[model samples]
Target: MSRRQRLMTLTRMLPSLLRILRRFRPYLRPQAPLLAGALLALLLSTAARLLEPWPLKLVIDRVVVATPSGGVSGIALIDALDPTTLLTLAAIALVGVIAVRGIASYFSTVGFALAGHRVLTEVRNDLYRHLQGLSLSFHDRAKTGELTLRIIGDIGMLKEVTVTAILPLLASSLVLVGMIAVMLWLNWQLALAALLPLPLLWLTTLHFGRRIQAVSREQRRREGAMAAKAAESMAAIRDIQALSLEKGFAESFCCEGNRDLREGVKAKRLAANLERTVDVLIGVASALVLWLGARLVLTGALTPGDLIVFLAYLKTAFRPVRELAKYTARLAKASAAGERVVDLLDEESDVQDRPDARPAPAFAGAVRFEQVTFAHTPGKPVLDRIDLALKPGERVAIVGPSGAGKSTLLSLLLRLHDPTEGRVLLDGVDIRTYRLASLRAQMSVVLSDSLLFAASIRDNIGYGAAGSDTGAEPGADEAAIIRAARLANAHDFIEALPNGYDTLVGERGVTLSSGQRQRIAIARAALRPSPILILDEPTTGLDRHNAQAVIQALEKLAQGRTVLMVTHDLDLAARADRILYLEAGRIREEGCHAELLAREGAYTALVRGRSGPPSPALSPAITRPIGADYAFGP
Candidate 1:
């Protein structure tokens, strides 16, 4: 099996709590000192609890009953005092014990909470980084909402469980152990009677705990599915509204939401049942211990003060059991969330740099694909064995039918995915030998559908320079940005806007028209100082005026760069120095436009198919003059 497969199998094999602790141990290590302090405080609080009942016992034995002969050893001063002063001292001691326990408990809780927050914050950061590093294939198969839930919702839940449930359970267990030891030492018979309901408590806990966890896990799963649905619907709200699909999507989302609600109710019901069952068991144990202790006190075998202290310890001992039942459901839910996070972390990316990979040097932009082949699925090659090369400063266009692997060629050259066989070389070095970041820094791309962030136009354009190896601070060179925007014919409209370059664009650039968005994207790409320029259907949807402006921008952007254009616009392809006609993953024809048309093959048919009723203004004969301020010029 592969490493990812083995990890997945192991994730399923291990218990949830154990898996989470073991897998996330690295995050826990840094918080060790804080966690240790929290644990120490908890122990001190447990010790305070053990001493809590003694002051009451002292009042009963020494002051109320007037037992004169017996006094606590090593405290003769207290025994030397009169009954009224002794009563006052006992009362003060009771408050002091309660106060000490309260103070320790507060510190312990705060410490645990601080540690949990720090550790979970690191976990969330690592989870997000891992998700970003994962290959496109993993993302193509994953849900955005579910991944978002793991980062925000799941990690937040883990924090809550760690502080509120896990720490308290650990402290309660210590109290249970300490109280039980004292009860046994005080009176063995009464202690044994106090332990009778424990076996039944154990069985009840086991039964109800499993059911609650199962219900909680299912509820969490449904919640994730619901979130995924909501996110998907929101992301495509425009398309859904245009197509009138809102009702159907809403109904589907509500169905998942309702199912999640039902599971949540079921989990709560199970937890409630468990708590009540535990209460009954605790009541029976308390009654048995009280009955036996009272008889012992009356028969002179046990003192009245001793019986009172014994009962107090007995009550405290069962507190852990009651708490265990109370927090069992929350722990189970967090465990389910932890499993989800671990499963995501286990997914190994199909694409990553080799250990010996080095940063890519600056490129002259000569590219070659030698016997290259690739497939998203085995035996279904998207690009077959094909040899191709481009000289430095050459402009090459690729045209083919849908699914002809034209775009796949661009993807391979960009190193988005490695070839299934053979190699792709840039300036005679295999692209795989270069670091991904540095290799990608040598190229700039403009796509058909431009996407923009919800930021100012200046910031969006600044991203291009950020990706380059310019070594300049991002957005620091506003003069260069304005120059690029001018080259793309985008400066006039941008300045006409209410806020000019600093105007905020809506998500995905929905606030702007298509031509304006495209011009801005061109400006962004033009800002990059890369030797290779990639244009994929850059003018596909533009109107005549915008298309003419974009073509003029492209003419400037193409100067002195190795330009690779993928388009169905025969008019654009005809302008390239050479054209490669691809069909079914293989290069069918390659030559200058006139030479390809002379061959009377796929290239001729493609051109004829698109050129039947073309406008004269968009004709192949029309050409644009290049500007002095070149996009890729040094």
Candidate 2:
């Protein structure tokens, strides 16, 4: 960060500052009175401090020295007053000046702190709200720890500028202007000498501030990365332990940790050097003022009283400059933080609904994907020219060897990611034409592993009802939650727990078994009463009995609702009103289980390969776990 780089950084941040002001404008107008009062307090404090040295000058030249009577010199007009009386008056005035300044300073600090707090609260709320609406793709590519740092650490740093940087700079600038005006009035020659070092101080700020800013920026970036690394490692700790890769993860974390430490140290070092340079400059200015003022006084060109007053104001004035100079690094860090926040807020979401989009109509459970093609990355297609339709109450199972886009097709119905080309519709209306929330509300999804909050099991189960306790309704009524749980075969196990449904589950429901979590998730989806339901590998990873229990629960959930299940289990596929066999992103075969098997094509071969022989037809009891044998096929 040289001077040029610092300038560039400031230029870049100018827009962001305007952005901040725009955000605060709504809050600021309402609190203008408080802000005005705060500024007034600062002004009054500076006025009192300026009044302070005048009393000392009067005491020295008029009270103690008792200038040649009459209307003597510039200040001695009290001819009849005793020296003791005059001195006492001057002393009292000094104390009163100090008291007023202290009181005003207190008010200034409190007002700014409260105002900053209120404004920052609004900012955080808006940022968080925007974050919640961003598309899934945005979150998929973003690191949790980095986003957390932006929300917490970055915003916190910007707050420092509000409370510490801006106010202090304003007060310091005010003090500088008033003090120098008085100094020039006292004696122009001495004031000139005192102010000469200002240019040098500015130069010093640029010289040192750049290095500090550069190092600080690096430090902030490194810390964010380190936080992200730590969070990622902790999140995957179970996998690391199971795979015996803890040592590898620990080493990687340490490497980033060390980089962050070095950058932090470098930034601190630069800040220290900047502080010392400013301190030295302040000393030089003070010494220069004293040397010239003393010379003027002894030559009868100025009074001793005048010289003392000038020196006092000069010294006090330089203190603000010193404080300002010391804060360059701090201001830079704050600016960096603001920049990061602005960048995140500026991110555009591709999945947001159109401006004309309205609430989705009640779904009839009719779905259509017309010429849908998608690619997570361009040139490597996942689905090509996909076309499918299902009527109300239709139960469709999508089966394919791995990499056949079964899950992708299900995701399209929910619009987690829209197709790169083509359209998906619900009941003849393009789904994207409807508000995202309403569209999602019409479909209930039960993933193989759906997350539960770290709240009571009752709250977790209740959340499944879109817009109910979790989505729209009132308190998570215990009766309603239990009903859904019973429907999903989760009530029995939930009651077996010490606290039943009231038990607080750990993060992601880690305290419960895979089967228990799945059933709770199923109960949540079942509670949604949505016209459409999707179950992805609903019994994946479950033991035989749990799988049997889950299958039964699914059978009930599938009734009435138009259900789409993605699975490899021949037994599950047999239960669908119709099953589609997908391969290479296209529908290769579709019909009842018997029809597909009798044709003895792609669908028949897949069943035979996994089940070890071709059967007369698909059985309704062959539940088996398939691994990468499922991600993609040869």
Candidate 3:
């Protein structure tokens, strides 16, 4: 990115970061009194540190210096006082300063820690919410591990910068300014000599800062890639183990991890060199100040006391410069992290609600695809010029070979993706004209591979139903759920489990058989009772017995709902009100099961395992009856 662009991005993020911090206002506001007390202590400590050199000067110029008159009995001598008394007073002041500084440091550390955590919490929450609002295409392209790192690791890095670095740097800068002002007043020439190296120091810091930022950005990117690799490996562990690809995955993970480590080491090395350089510069500046002050004293242009004070301020002045060098790399690292977070937040969702869109009224589920065409990539259409229509309460089956756009057609209906051309309509209104949420709310979908979260069986069953009743409604009234489960042939096995309805399913329902999971998904979809239903190979994983049971449940579910089934099962397609035979990206042929069989086209060859056109006199069993509402003209 260009410097100006980076600056503008940072400027935009400042408001959001500030807003995140404000979430901790309640915690911070309550600690205001303590913070004020801490500030008072800090000021007192700074005053004490500044005053320490003045007293050393007083002792040197008065008590240690011989007076022209035989004895030193002036105000400076009085201020120096008896050795025992002076030691006692100095000790007391040192203790007081240390006590105040310690208290202030504690309060500041604790307060900022609370604020940082609260801000991180807000960041995570906002990121997660934004992720939810983002379109499916975004998720399809994003790595789970990388996104997780942004939500967890990146936010954690920001928390550290906020609590440990930002406030301390601010306080240190204040101390530096105070010391510089005092040093300049004492001896302008000596102060200038001490400050001479500052310009070089700043230049070096800027160079190192840029390098650190670049390295840190690379490190974070590699870290995210490593995380993505690890997550992908873990998610597909079964496949890896079955294929004996463990070593391959491990090598891949190691490669990413090593890249991150190399970048991190490079960043650390640069930071270390920057700090060492600052230290050497400060040492040289200190030596120069001392040498200059001694010359002024020898020339009677400066007092021994003044020289001591100048030396002390010189040390104090370099302290912040050294700190600035120390934290320059840290700031750079944080800037890179901030840039990434801002990038995610700035990303625009590809599918967004139209400003004039309205919620779809209750749908009777009449669906239409008017020459819909779509593709994940340009000029590579997955569904092309597909025109079809389903009247209210009609059941249609889409049958085709794999990669023939059967599933793609179903995705269009659900608006998982919008058609690149034409439109999908519901109840005669363009689907795009209706709010996405309202349009989706009218339909229920069950996929071949159903994912169940790690939750109670009851929760999973009631996943689609609103206002769940585990108590008010008798266990029997859960009969509806049980009945749905029974129809899916899942109730018998479920009842045999220890907790039955209350059993907690493991993550992704791994504890359940594939057939069981599919049945549960069907039960969930059935519970929705929407006017529209989508079953994408819903019985693919089931055994003959289980598949039969599921088909029976589905038959009831499809009764009054507009049903769209994407499947390769010819028998199931034969029972549909109408069958759409898809080839490549278009509907090559469509008709009632008997009529399509008579035509002896792709459907006939697919069903009879023939290489040519089908015979008209195919057996009645071979040409099953299409449902009552079936219609197919093209």
Scored by lDDT, model 1 comes in at 0.84
In terms of lDDT, the best-performing candidate is 1
Clashes of each: 0, 8, 1
Worst 10 residues of 1 by lDDT: 625-634
User: What are the runs in model 3 whose C-alpha is more than 4 Å off?
Assistant: 1-90, 298-309, 327-329, 466-487, 610-634
Clashing pairs in 2: 402-631, 402-632, 403-631, 403-632, 467-471, 467-472, 468-472, 468-473
Could you estimate the TM-score for every candidate? 0.92, 0.91, 0.83
Cα lDDT of model 2 by residue, 490-587, tens digit: 99999999998889999988999988998898888878868999988777777766777777787777778888889876666766788898888999
Name the 10 consecutive residues with the lowest summed lDDT in model 3.
Answer: 467-476
Each candidate: RMSD to true structure? 4.8, 4.3, 5.9
Sort by TM-score, best first: what order? 1, 2, 3
Top-scoring candidate (TM-score)? 1
Higher TM-score: candidate 1 or 2? 1
What lDDT tens digits, residue by residue, belong to model 3 across residues 1-634?
A: 4556555555654675565455435546655665676566556556656666655665566556533331243568555577566656656765676666667666656655665576567767887888877877788999999999888888788888877677677667667788888878877778889889988886777667667877877888888888898889888888999999999999988888888788878988998999999999888988988888889888877777787788777777677777767776677667667667767766677766789999778888899999899988999999999999999988899976779899888888887788899999888888888777777767888888888879877678777564222222222347677877776667888899999988899988999988788878877777665799998987775665666666766776677888899976666777788999998998988998889989989887877745433222222324564322222112
